[model samples]
Each structure stands twice: as C-alpha cells, then as structure tokens.
Target: MKKFIMCFVGAMLVLSLAACTPTPVKQSESATEPMVEASTGGASDKVPDPNVEPMEIISVYSSNEDATGLNQAMDAVDELTAQSLVDKLIEYGVLEEGTEVLEFDTKDGIGTLDLSKVPSSGTSGELLMLTAIGNTFTENFELDKLKLLVDGKNYSSGHIEHGDNDYLEYNRDYKKL
Candidate 1:
C-alpha cells in the first residue's frame, strides 16, 4: 500500500541520520584510562612527545601584563598540552597550583577545554583566566575559537555562565587585573 511505502521511507531516513552521527568520545573514570578520539585531519590533534623534538617554542599567555596588555611567557613545547599551558600559567601566577586540565581536544578549528575546576576568583579574574586559556590554545593550535567546559559541561561559575554554544575568541589585548 502507498501508506506502507511512505512509512518505510521515513523510517529509512531516520535510520540513515542516526547512522551518520559521529560517535562521541567516552569520558574516562580515571587518569590512568586516557580517553582517545580518532583524528580526522593532521598531526595537530596529537600532542607531540616531549622527548622527541627540536623543541618548538609556544607563547604561554598570562594574566600578568603591562599597559599594552600583551603578556606571555615563551615556553618550549616539549609536550603540547592544555595542562602544560596551565602549568605555565600557574608559574606565572594566573591560576592556582592545584587546578587540573580534565580534558582537551581540537577538531575543525575548534578547541575544547574541560577543566577539573574553574577558580572562584571574581569576574575580572575569571575573565583574565579565560582570556589566558583561549588565547593560549587558539594561537598555538591555529584554532578559530575555544570552548571552555567544566567537568564535561558548559563553564558556569559565580562570575560567568557560558551557553551551550558559547566559545572564547583569541584576544591579545587583555590587561593585567
């Protein structure tokens, strides 16, 4: 019957869409079990080994800056990692020593930063921290935007709330607070 045929076609279409959806990367329960996603593009997705390089220098952004608002520390990319950058920030007094990078991934020019925690600093401090993160990742990875997530969800703190689709842009002019 004509009705049966239409129903079959609609079912097929729904099945096709579901099939085309990309599988999400599963979150690991512990640091020992590292979560891995398949890379669709170049080597940028994989962080280089710290031991194997004619070290590449990367600009590690910091909240510490003078009038021009461009504050950065040059660091050798022994391992290109979100945590490494965070470590640099801590060294520069941007973030606390205990903070950890929960997850970091980049695809199609969008980088995601899932953090174990976001500092309870006030609005200005929060903005500066985000600026440091966004600029550091975008510049180093050649990404267009950076998404900040706390514990696998959109970043929400007493200071700021990012929407589901919200992202941070690379900004170089953030002044010291």
Candidate 2:
C-alpha cells in the first residue's frame, strides 16, 4: 500500500512540473502572435503580427543553419528599445511633441516598428530619422546589418549605418514621444 502511495505521489509531482513548463506555440491565439523566447537572457520576446509575419534570413541552402544565433541575439530585446527610439526622435526635434514610433529594434537585432504607432506625424528630416534608428541598431548587433523596411518596402535612403564607434554615441533628445 505504501509503495503504491509513493508511486502516486511521484506521478503527481511529475505532472505538476509538466504543467508549469511553457507549452509550444500551438494554440490558435499563439498562431497569430508567435512568441520568440530568448534561450538565456530574460529579454523581450517578439510577437510577429498575424497580418504580416517577419521573415528570417537563414544561413542558406548549403550551410543550412536556422540562424538561431540571430534569434538568440534578439532575445535580449524588449519593447523599451522601440519606445526609446521614439523618445530620441522627439528630443532631436525631428518628431513633434507626441509622435509615435512605428517600430524599432528588439534586443535581438530584429527591429519591430509600427510607424502608425507614432503619436503624430513626424516633423524631422528623413536623414535624421534614418540615422537615429540605423545607428541605434548597429551599435548593438555588430554581426549583421539592419535592413529598414517601411510598409514592406526598404526605408528609402542611403548610408549603411556602421558600428565600430569608440564612444557610446546615440542621440539624446530625452523625450518620450
């Protein structure tokens, strides 16, 4: 009787742990917002839009790697980076008092921007806006370059933003627009 009771208790404990484990993105709701979990760091998890999911640039046909490194890199990202971009634009006086950020970088290199999220229309130079975002991203992800696309098109501009800067120089407007 004691052995049977012990067996039941162990089974119950095992079941409880299984319950605590996070399930895969299989539910209908999760299908719309596929969560990206950071393997180690407790960073921001990106939820791709159900309307348009972002595509990944993998290692390719020959090497055949998922580029999980890139995915892992993004794990440290959070929504705050997107918010900070908006704030910086406002401080530079390029964005008006309440312009919203469409989208921008995750801790991983993937930038998730919602230009419609900008509180109001932007009031800044396109170049200024471009560099603010490009430079901000390149500063962190030194491995791959960022490709800015607005409404599914390349963020029309030139100048490949580069890292390798000695100073931690990002624009400081200090406003949360």
Best by TM-score: 1
* Per-model TM against the reference: 0.63, 0.30
Question: After superposing candidate 1, which stretches have Cα over 4 Å from the reference?
Answer: 1-53, 65-70, 175-177
In the range 1-177, model 2's lDDT, one tens digit per residue, is: 999999999999999999999987555654766666557533444555798644432111010132111111122222335455445445544345665655454445344444532222233334344444444554543423455544444443343332333122233331211
Using lDDT, give the best candidate's number. 1
After superposing candidate 2, which stretches have Cα over 4 Å from the reference? 1-80, 104-112, 117-125, 140-143, 151-153, 156-177
Count of clashing residue pairs in every prediction? 1, 12
Task: Estimate the Cα RMSD of every predicted model relative to the unseen true structure.
Answer: 20.3, 18.8
Q: How accurate locally is residue 151 in candidate 1, as Cα lDDT from 0 to 100?
A: 87
Taken over the whole model, the C-alpha lDDT of each candidate is 0.81, 0.42
